[model samples]
Target chain A: MIRTLLATIALALWQTAALAQTNHQHVSGSACGEAVLRCASKVTPAFAPDGTLWLAWLAGGQVSVASSKDGGQTLSAPVAVTKLPLNLDTGPDARPKIAIDRNGGIAVAFAIFKDKAFNGQVFATRSADGGKSFAEPRPITSSSESQRFETIGVDADGSVFAAWLDKRNRIRAQQSGRKYEGAGLFFASSKDGGATYAEARLASDNTCECCRLGLAFAGPGRPVVVFRNIFEGGVRDHAVVSFADPATAGEVRRVSNDDWRIAACPHHGPSLSISAAGTYHVTWYSNGKARKGLFYARSQDEGRTFSEPLALGRPDRNPARPYVLAGPRGTVMVWKEFDGERTAVNVTISHDEGRSWTKPVAVATTKDTSDHPLLVSDGHKAYLSWMTKADGYRLVPVGDEP
Target chain B: MKRRLLAAIFLLGSLVAAPGADTTSDFKLKPFGRGSWQEVLRAHAGRPTLVHFWGATCGPCKVELPLLGKFMKEHAGIEVVTISADLVPDLPGATRAMLEKAGLRPAENWIFSDGFVERLRFEIDPTWQGDIPRTLLIERDGTITTIEGSAEIPVLEQWSTRQRAAPK
Candidate 1:
């Protein structure tokens, strides 16, 4: 009986090894020709709070979203989430984003291209039935056009927060939808599952444009937004603010004081991941005159303040587009490094809070092509998604070992 | 008669003094102006005009434009042009000079002259919020056939070769 049990155990182990080496289908049919525009700025995929993957990309001058259930294996046909007409002037690299509610509903948002200018407007669509179908996209800001850099976040209670860098009331009046806004962060919310949103509120002001806005839910209905702020003398630094109800009211606060100074837009932004105990881990890219590095900081008391940012990458190669996600095992941070003509994705892991980090591993390779990578983690298994040099995309799974 | 002659001379002189008179009207392409976008598009009306909008600062556009030059040369009877939207003032006496250095000189070249920028915006797609190195393939009937931010050599070559072989 003991011999027979040993043989069965060996057989099981062999099966497990075989499955791990199994190759995952990396590329599907290319969205080429008129269906998908040819550009460096392409699709960005994220997982819904319900483990279903969602992809958002620009197609035919409009933003679109598609869903996948089998862990990025197969995708549903893309659906037009932006109701804006085909002639609406949308810009490149301003991808649409989606966040999932506690009940598994989804909220999607992106900017609009208008009037010989990218008069950036934020629009949101909701899927109450867990993405079976999405409700029509509705405008979240006033009709008076302004340049906006918008992002969305949903909490456990289904409250939604959409934040953007608004420039309607700035003194200098920067170019709409092109340059960094010289104003504060504006927000609108939906408590009834994104069916209706509150009037726009000023969360914070004096934020940079070109930098992306990030949002992470702290608790039942409270969420926080992290973005690069433009301080005095055109310094670009990272900042965070919280929403008391997130569904209503204008409760926003700045969380950090890096004070990095620069004259040009970095085209990089901050990313956030919230722990179960409401700890906020924010990572951003900074290259001031004094120093330049990828910095990471954490806030234990719900983003009241943050620890000093720990620089991860080397000085010679500045990392771009750093993404952080707090998984069940630990916090995962991923970024891309440009090496002359090639680009590579790097991932660093931390297990004991943000105290320590693992050796960074390369996830994807870009051999002489502009590869814009995006990452999404479902609190357990993290996936790295990026466009390849040959007009393709990849999804790399970084799961903790047993 | 003498007074009328003076008035006509004054009128012609004023028309020359008007801004954009040289470019906005009767802006013909010269022999040295190889790959001029306007002349090529006007000559090849009703056929697809493959325009490669390039810039000196853009790396991708640099590589893509040379391949386009060779491709246009190889495929006879195919009309292709490149618009060099280089800042005219920044490269004083250097606009045509740099085209030679960059090897972008083909049969018809058009450096977006002063005042032509606004006119092209209205002529083509008004909704075109200007992005650099933009590639536009307009069909024969003046309708935009394909519009994109960038193009690869293989894809463009294949598409143009196929169209060249197709029946008119």
Candidate 2:
């Protein structure tokens, strides 16, 4: 709350005067210059049934997709999901989402800013014939004040479940002169790959609106989601919800109590993965007085009880954007750390569920801007998918190949 | 021809000259990077300033920014500078509109450059974890008070009172 500025003052003369310029084109060359996979600034990966890796990425103001036959060494030509460029939502948690169901169906979801007030709208499109083409993109829900941070997951029966933070209830409260806190968690399902969606329904209210929701399927029909929820007194903590089906919203279960109270957005979210051992593994960033920095925890009693939070990453390096995946080689976690020179993507592998983890290792490093590290598994192995400016798109396989 | 030559030279030199801020022209937002932090701080050096960080995606910042503009107006001695930490596409227009709505002009308006934002953030203060609505109250003697979330008016008022009480 109170700190002196001696260091900044010592460094005051280092940075010279800036011009009356607002042009960022020449100064900010961290972004690759095209709408292709190599030029992508943000990338999300999903593995197909046949071990093919499909990636949806945002680049040059366009959402494009490409497939890799052999473990991301090379990618097929990019295919545009939207014909014309749109005002994409490339915020901290906002990016293009992809889900590949069994029988090779591809579904994609992304958000775009609708107005200057920052009201957002989520769009969904699909490809029936592999990645050859895509249908026209449409809003995920009709009644939208602002819908963002949309997440899509595929069930075993090839159905896709979509969940997002929506502000429709906030608008309703505004009209009725009732005060509203945060946004609501809303969801829908596409039984026929994402060509069309069922009616959107409210899953939970007062969920933190700015962060992304962690999504994974429990069984064939059930979907589990972890999100930053707005508890009483404006405490934004992590919570998990299990759905009986696409339409039935389950009880909101508290994941952990970090007691972070703020009236603003974290931009940082949470990640969830359900192991074959049926253990629920989650990781997130929190600044609560009870805990700080990145942490990981697991639940084996069907979201009933969780182990003590296992803090991840070093304190001095400033660990952030932790992603966890329960895969063939147990649970894999990855995050980004800066060393005052280069930002490195570090990984830790746990062979015995979440009981313990291997020493964290830096699998990739870049000296410039980068995207959050995301983990994807191909039913056989887990892979780290990251996009960086110094290096291009990286798809390094983490953990051992089982 | 000589007059046109002089005008071109003047325009070229202005590019490197100080961030001759012009909020009237839709916000003269300079591209802020790691190397530009010193320059930004130098602009408000020796003056009691309130440096606030915000972004387009942050909802709470939208509500607090207009009030901050009013606070600066009410306190004529203290200066308020806002730096946009947005990394989104099509940002300049939106940022300008936000400043106009908040009435935070004639004050320095800076935007995060397109480099690795972590570097830019680290340069400002290595400990900042990129939290929005974060502000720093700089006294005339260069003492800084860091506010994590929104800045409380009482805190700002205390800083103002301290500055007023300090030796001129």
Candidate 3:
């Protein structure tokens, strides 16, 4: 009577290189292939000062970057960031981050899993001679137990600011027999336009272990970072920290109280943008009792206080992975909505610095799996950078509502 | 007496290959695709089943998995199944190795075959927003009790004990 048929059981830490799988994604009629732009798991786009759109994508265990002059209509030949195929971190929240400085310097950062336990090492590479070639990628931190969900932002002075979720503190606590709730947030800045980075510094400890971080800039040396923070009761809610300067870690302030208290991974992280009016607009997904889906909030008082949480999409449709950007024309946010069959990328805009908004609309729709919808702008116009399996890469101009 | 001797030898032979070591051949890593959920339910139609979902990168899962194996050794009557949320052809060796190290012999293991993780996750549970260390327990009548986050061993043991004591 104890005969039970268990179905799918996966445990961790099996040592086998012989049967290690290399083919994760299938080639789609020459379109669903690997190691190319179209077959990327996640794609990130950044606009250069000269309006050249730069994209970095992870595919076939390698990171590649390409530039588009016509606003993603056509691209230059791709340059490989990683020489060898690595155990790249392919988490849903994982993506290569790219930033362009004022002098057209390209700085790229992405992560690779170092061990079977899913520990990650983030690598940074820079292109000084435009898009011709990139330097050898190096680890951002000297001590590398784990680092992930790294984000890159170009400060007003054209220096690169990098922030990521770090686990060095967790390892230290475990060694000292102290209980650490979650990972910590660490940051670094490159005064030399990302050629060489300064020493990595801790912004805050006990940050959420997983999920991505949202990075923005306030002024020349000021960088603002937003991520999931573990509260006193183990409630992993979102928080924002504004750096006084590149070296100083600012106070950790609650973005909103969704009260998502769980010891598991949400995979879904928050998105942030700082308007010219000095308002902090953030969007994140929470399954807490107070909030059950995607929500957007804005804080006019720096990162100190936020507005009431505004729900995003219909609960039945499953809105996820929202991205917010404050562009020159206006502020735009995009997220994915799955209605069982087709998945649509929806967009909402605010012309008055997030004080009001337009209704969310399906800017792009695909019947197949797609990367998270992201927005990129060139001061004059904003566009949606969406990559899908069925369709190739899409860069659609969303118009300037401002 | 001869049959009992062969069975005993076979059991010993399997145990010799099951501890502290694992290769792909040591365990079966099947495909848990879009429609495999229903097939799994049907396979254990009238029996109690435990299906676990984990990923190699999941921190809490690494802690909970080995403990689950120890629990399985104590309760031989309950079936334990696991599915990896991580895409196959990745670093899936750790999952197989961990399963073996935990002494979860005779385990039914599956991996996410499709690259579209969201759709696959939706099939298992629409409410699940891709959290690891999650589990689902199905009773004889196909009533599923979901244990979100890392499962508690005592809760699982009590549930299994309760099922055995229930009238069939």
Per-residue lDDT for B1-168 in model 2, tens only? 667655644543443232323355634788776678788678778888899998877888888888888888888899888999865633665677777788887678888865678888878877666778788998777788888777777778888888888886
Can you list each candidate's DockQ? 0.02, 0.23, 0.18
Best of the candidates, lDDT: 2
What is candidate 3's DockQ?
A: 0.18
Off by over 4 Å in 3: A1-34, A399-402, B1-22, B87-89
Instruction: Write model 2 residue lDDT over A341-399, tens digit each, in one string.
Output: 78999999898888989999999999988889999999988899998877888889899
lDDT of 3 by residue, A280-306 (tens): 989999988688889999998888889
Which candidate number maximizes DockQ?
2
TM-score of each: 0.62, 0.89, 0.89
Cα deviation at B59, candidate 2, in Å, is: 0.8
Model 1 per-residue lDDT tens digits across residues A36-126: 3232135677676667777776544455667778865676776666433232212223567777766677777766532212235566678
lDDT of 1 by residue, B1-168 (tens): 667655654543443232111222333334213234455667878776777555443323444565666777776666676665532111212334334544545546665543223224334433332334566766656655544444666777777776777567
Q: Could you give me the TM-score of model 1 versus the true structure?
A: 0.62
Q: Once superposed on the true structure, which residue ranges of model 1 sit more than 4 Å away at CA? A: A1-33, A36-40, A82-93, A128-133, A171-181, A247-258, A368-371, A389-391, A399-402, B1-168
Task: Quote the TM-score that chain A achieves in each candidate.
Answer: 0.81, 0.92, 0.92
Model 3, A211: alpha-carbon shift in Å? Answer: 0.6
Worst 10 residues of 3 chain A by lDDT: A1-10
